[model samples]
Target: MANIEQSASAFLQSRRSVPAKMLGLPVPDRAALMPLLTAGLRVPDHGKLEPWRLLVLEKAAMTRLAALAVTRAGELGLDAEKAVKGSAQFETGNLAVVVISSPKPSDKIPLSEQVYSAGAVCLSLLNAALAAGWGANWLSGWPSHDREFLARGLGLHDTETVAGIIHIGTAQNSPPDRPRPDVAARVEWVSA
Candidate 1:
């Protein structure tokens, strides 16, 4: 048990996301991705209401979505820089998993909690891919938040929102380690 705990701690401490732009080919196929998806689904749920679903976007889908993002940006009269930033991920991505936050009508569980669970799934999926020796990153840009883009490109319902898009592929380069937060400054202990 101690060994298991120590291993988990070590993995968590060292886990870092590879940049989406740095990710390249040899993405995980459906067979290889299934286990990662399974691990992602093991997040906490207060009411057992699984308020999340995944949309796997392959190369073709990524291209289509990139076009849609550009079109949507045009319709919204966004600047060229914003439009480019919005579509860049899809344009270069070989494969991505869209974690959709599909909230259910529930009396007991709050909507915020359901949304949080979806976010947890996104992190879990990203971590699982990294652990499996794949480069992975979680991202959401203006395209993810635009209603028109979500409706047309992803077929998202009114109650559904983009939790995150986890891009997975072979890493083109290793990034230098960035500064981490000061844990002591962020933590507060309470004893009664």
Candidate 2:
């Protein structure tokens, strides 16, 4: 196989999301994170709206978010068990990047298109972290959907919302591969 083709194929085949709970410390520092962040920005954006923003949360911020999650859960009348589970990420996270879907006012581009750009940014960041030898997982729990949690914890504007919360750290263990979708069954070929 050609060098480029072989490497790309191998990487795509081996890519997997390590569980956030299984991830440990030693996450990328600001100096080390620049390249990865740059790579993440290489995504499709119609109208150049760039309808997204990244919020990096280190240990202190993570701790604060976790506490806030629990408090917000109670105020929302969420079940105790679920509330605790939702707050676990904030308490345990070594590092995280919250992708905020901050859609812009665009007459040409639809709102859905702007939202998809944000989603793409999330995936791009996740992939960049994984490629840089970090254990990365894209996650969204009850707190992400809570308006009070987002506003109070992250200072997100009313127009902005969580697209994804990407957790990054060292890998404690490699999870076994799960079943994949049957592409052949899902695909349809069109003929003129």
Candidate 3:
């Protein structure tokens, strides 16, 4: 048990998100991704509501979404830079998993908690992919938050929104570790 705890701590400490552009081919196939998805599902759900669902996008789907992003950007009168940046992920992605937050009508569990669970699932999926020897990054841009884009491109219901889009693929290079937060400054202990 101690060994397991130590290993988990080590993994958590070292986990880093690879840049989406740095990810390449050799993405996980459905068979290979199933176990990772299973791992991702093991997150906190206070009401057992399972207020999250995954949508896997292959290369072709990504291409389609990329085009949609550009069109939506035009319709919205966004700047060229914003449009390019927003659509870049879909344009270059080989495989991605869209973690959708599907809030359920519940009296006990708050909607915020359900949304948090969806965010947790996104992290779990990204971590699972990294642990499985694939590079993974969680990303969300203007396109993700735009209602029109979500409705047309993803077929998301009014109650459903994207929690994250996790891009997974083989890594081109090992990214240098960026500075981490000062945990000591952020922590406050309370004992009563």
lDDT of 1 by residue, 101-192 (tens): 99999999999999999999999999999989899999999999988899999999988999999999999999668999999999999997
lDDT for model 3, on a 0 to 1 scale?
A: 0.96
TM-score for each of the candidates: 0.97, 0.96, 0.98
* Poorest lDDT segment (10 consecutive residues) of candidate 1: 170-179
lDDT of 1 at 4: 87
Task: Provide the global lDDT of candidate 1 against the true structure.
Answer: 0.95
Clashes of 2: 0
Tens digit of per-residue lDDT, candidate 3, span 48-107 = 999999999999999999999999999999999999998999999999999999999999
TM-score for predicted model 3 compared with the true structure: 0.98
Model 2, which residues run further than 4 Å from truth? none
Query: Going through the candidates in order, what is the number of backbone clashes in each?
Result: 0, 0, 0
Predicted structure 1: clash tally: 0
Please give the lDDT score at residue 68 for candidate 1.
91
- Tens-place lDDT per residue, model 2, 1-192, is 699899868887879999899888788899878887788778899999989999999999999999999899889898999999999988988999999999999899999998999899889999989988999999999899889899999999999999999999999998667998798999999997
